[model samples]
Target: MPDIAPQPGVVEALGQIVGARYVIGPGHDQEPYTTDWRGRYHGRAEAVVKPADAEEVAAVVRFCAENGIAVVPQGGNTGMCGAATPSPSGRSVVLRLDRLNRIRWTSRLGDAIAVDAGCILADVQRAAEAVDRLFPLSLGAEGSCQVGGNLSTNAGGTAVLRYGTMRELCLGLEVVLPDGRLLDLMTALRKDSTGYDVKGMFVGAEGTLGIITGAVLKLFPRPRASAVAMAMAEEPEQVLDLLALARTRLGDRLSSFEVMSRRQVEVIAQHMPDVVIPFGLESGWYALVEISDTLAGDALPPMLEAVLGEALEAGLVGDAIVASSEAQAAGLWRIRHSVSESSKAHGYVVSHDSVVPLEKQAEFIRAVEAAIIAAEPSATVVMHGHVGDGNIHVLGILDPARFASAEALRARAAEISLAVDGVLAPLGGAISAEHGIGVSNRERLRRVANPIELELMRHFKAVLDPQGLMNPGKVLPDALPA
Candidate 1:
């Protein structure tokens, strides 16, 4: 799609809200806002507006609201689902909130932080660590992804096994309503029973409801001592059993239980040689376990050793390696973190982020693999994810030579995604576990989500965004009734 021509005096009105320098358009300066990080989604904005704070954001939004222009609120733009990208229609304006980056308040005793939505996640973590606290949201994109996008997508990362997703980590929020009103709910209160869970409505709404301006995030005490273990297992059941043992033995200390296929390990080995993977390629599966100790003493390593030793007796562990030093532990984590990058390097892949009931995960993977292979025999599955939380990425990597063009590959991607959903739906899993239903999974969401629930979601969308101007054509299959 081509860039939309500017509405008469529209750019001038937006410039008046923030500034002419902030309201930029019509050339090379606007190129950066037109595409996503992955380069898969390309869009064109009428104008890119940089707002510094909620009031400024509201004024910009107010102009878009009055003029019937679509406003796409973007922060960092590190999303995989194209949620932050502008529309292909080129009529919308991009609202960049990066300038609002600020750590408003941090309370060590309260274990809470109030930050602007545009604050980078790693910056928040640094602020917490500076005070001997921990902000437990960690992901590959933490260095670049903004807090607002994390909360908007309810992102789940490696630490989700311990700290939970962004939704659970947040206490309150300050949002700019769709119609340009500021809703200030960024409070430090942990418990509020007065009304509905108002903050949750916008948590995973993908900015369709409003623009998240600021947030109150939960923090934790920093772990004083930690242990990391990488063990080989023959089957998913053995991995599950080993995880059960770790949870029972370590209890609250268990931080992450990541499962990766042997193929994932090989891909990482092939791509990243410096990172040490514990087990050899003899086994088809491996589990990466971590224990975070809050106490001053370093007891976690011995405890993890004891647990893995028990798993060995039970035949749940084939081969194992426990990190003796922090550098070694970081190396093991590097292996786990390299999974997605390695998979992307493999080939054209249709990735899934589905989560089933904990016990049903193995069966779900088996069923989906069986179904996919029966239909498309040449498909290869690369698996890795939070095994403790029942979320597994069952990516189907397609051969480049199979299809003649990119469009054909995408068509095949759609079919493969539906096949995954076929198995996932019957098992009561989500089409999107951590990634919200942006343009990527909105169709699947429409297909599988409860009709009544969808109707209510649309109702809420209409109520919050009466003009249907806030990130139109995202999260919902269709626009609210005009």
Candidate 2:
């Protein structure tokens, strides 16, 4: 929509591969594809092409490769990082895969399903439910996000404590190489010791290696009974104790153990008034615990209640409430899912998705909060995470009117992030847990990652994409000039 000029014959060549109507030119609505979900990054593209299937996608990539133009593969455009957004130079093509939505096949006996990468994540869950199976890769953005993006980011959601991340959930992948070759490795096998894991390289590559067209994902037996409870504690150590108690009592039945600070709950309640927070914001921290079993009966509720009762008796939990009905359970989860939306609406937020060891999580949070306050005394720090897995999301909210310009705010954010990384490094924590390293953390990764690891990543990128036309300036940092 800006005053950038479109490349000569680029749109026409892409249109020939798909169709003229499918290709969005300079005058069309490219904002949706060019901007990320959080509106943090905006880019310009010579054309946005929507291909119908893998063949058309290959053709488009082939054309882009031949022309030496960058090709950015986008799915649902729900990424937190700027992985899918193209550069502002307007010398790239945005290849959207929304039209490739399809469930190719499903096998309940084999516990696998082959689906097009463009399929909505929730749709895949529903399809698995239809076959009496479960696809447990649940997230807040499942309703609109696509499977391809999830795989690309290696997303870990609320249920990751039980089902693992997308890397563990996926069995195989179908990808289009940078040179336009369709590599079909969509096998629904549980174990295949055949050579190196070529498919694994593309799982979290953020479309830098190639564009994922389809996937064969693993499924599990659907849980027939479940119980949800919210417990309040005076401190994070108490929450960690409660997690240990729940796991000891419930064993593998425990599916999710989410911890949220009082500020996090207040943010949700303030923005989403309709969401019911059963317990008021008086405690220092809260934990949302869920346990499930394959047997359908009332036993699960009593088991959860017993666990909470024990935590209370042990002086670990100050207050607790168990959901009495399905609607009530959904309402509790609604509060958790509303955190991101409400935080964005609250103010300019600087967020981090880092993972620390379970024993170090409490200390990690304390140190990061102190660092944020030291950096900006007025910044309100809110925290939450899947404590069972040690992936915590820390956010610092600031008033937009205080900063003179966006660059000023970004500089402050970068300072805070560096302070956070400093705290995490000593405690043996990672800068990124679920979210992949897009442009947002590309430089951070280079600074924090081992030199040999970065070199190997560059080697792989060079071998797979010799021309460096696939999703340039993402994941790995730009190569230094000779």
Candidate 3:
């Protein structure tokens, strides 16, 4: 924690910008912002500031900068890491962007749209659809997560196989600097010849550099026809052939290709009974693929069938089922959606957001799972993720018999993660794929991050937030925001 607490006039100064009623100080009003979505990281803040607009936001930031109060700019508070959660020092201020939720307008051409940072992802998607366009940043938390948090963390969702992550989906952003200056880099331009892509830096910064307020996002023509299928492979190795076939057959139409381990699907079935697995446990590994195209016709179904039929014949896919209708397609997706939920329901699970080379993905999963189970036989290894893009989420579920308390299990999970990440690193993979390096991954980042790269990040942090007041404890080491 920084050597500072809330000054004498800190609360009064913050209240002046957004009103005392919105400035939550102590008691239950500030409780929600103190903890993360998973309840893994519990922290505290001097106050929670809810500003309705950017003007109020600037003022609040200015006040905080003056008072030496750290700012944790939060959007939906739906992040996995403790990036949004305040630290235990009780000296920082939690600045929430929920009040800034607003959909300004969509361009007539439907290529771009202006959205406030606090806009719910689902609302943004709906707004895009109203004009016959598509906001492709789809995630499980779309109904609750906000756009600002998505960009801040540079979230990678199912569509990253085709559309890309939140960083690529967005074109422009409005960020409030640590010094309380509003840098309006908001533009819908696809091409910009600038000295440095400063806007890009803040996209995945996790609020270490500054607070993201709004963004101009790129939109695509809504897919008129969508085809979804769930296919099983005899082995994880065979799934690679399926991926190559998908690219060759579907090309641009191939939107998402997610692979799930048999254990992951089985756990989902055992825990989440409502989320029906369309294709039962007939094979070792399963894949859920989706193809979206602008062309509107019944031909997509046959084309998908032909692709799967060829794979089936080639011995790449064991068995497959293409959804007959939209409802059926959504049903297939429900199974994919239930992986994380079911994994968490059992007990403390150490989740890893990692990616390996496409050629080594299968090998990585097999090796890591073997290593984990060998270490803890009772641990349920839940594995699945966007196999197309190489981003795989591996979870290590703790066995209650082995560990008496959640703390002990969680500590061991971190140790296992390091061992798992070590295997991933040599194979041209990263420990973190989409989830950024917040406080939760600070230690891992310190261990795995390149010495030069980590130094550069430290320099950037110092240059941006010289006083270390903007989200101090995140995306860095030894700079805890108290």
lDDT of 2 by residue, 331-414 (tens): 888888888998988898888888999999889989999999998888889998888999999999887788999999989988
The sequence of per-residue lDDT tens digits that candidate 3 reaches over residues 1-482 is: 33334567777888888988888775566778888888888777778889999878888999888877788898888887788988777878899999998898798574999999999999999999999999998778889999999999899999998999988998899999999999999898889897899999898899889888999999999999989999989887889899999899889999999988898899999999788776668689889999989989888888999999999999998899999989999998888888767887877777889888899987898889887877677788888999999999988888656887767777778778877877887888887788787887888888777899989988998899899988888888777665
Off by over 4 Å in 2: 479-482
User: Model 1: per-residue lDDT, tens digit, 301-337?
Assistant: 8899999999999999998999999988888888888
Worst 10-residue lDDT window, candidate 3: 1-10
Q: What is candidate 3's CA lDDT for residue 418?
A: 77
Report the backbone clash tally of model 3.
Answer: 1
TM-score of 2: 0.98
The TM-score that candidate 1 achieves is 0.96
Cα-based TM-score, every candidate:
0.96, 0.98, 0.97
Evaluate residue 212 in candidate 3 and report its C-alpha lDDT on the 0 to 100 scale: 89
Q: If the candidates were sorted by their TM-score against the true structure, best first, what order would they fall in?
A: 2, 3, 1
Off by over 4 Å in 1: 273-278, 480-482
* Candidate 2 lDDT: 0.90
The whole-model lDDT of each prediction reads 0.87, 0.90, 0.86
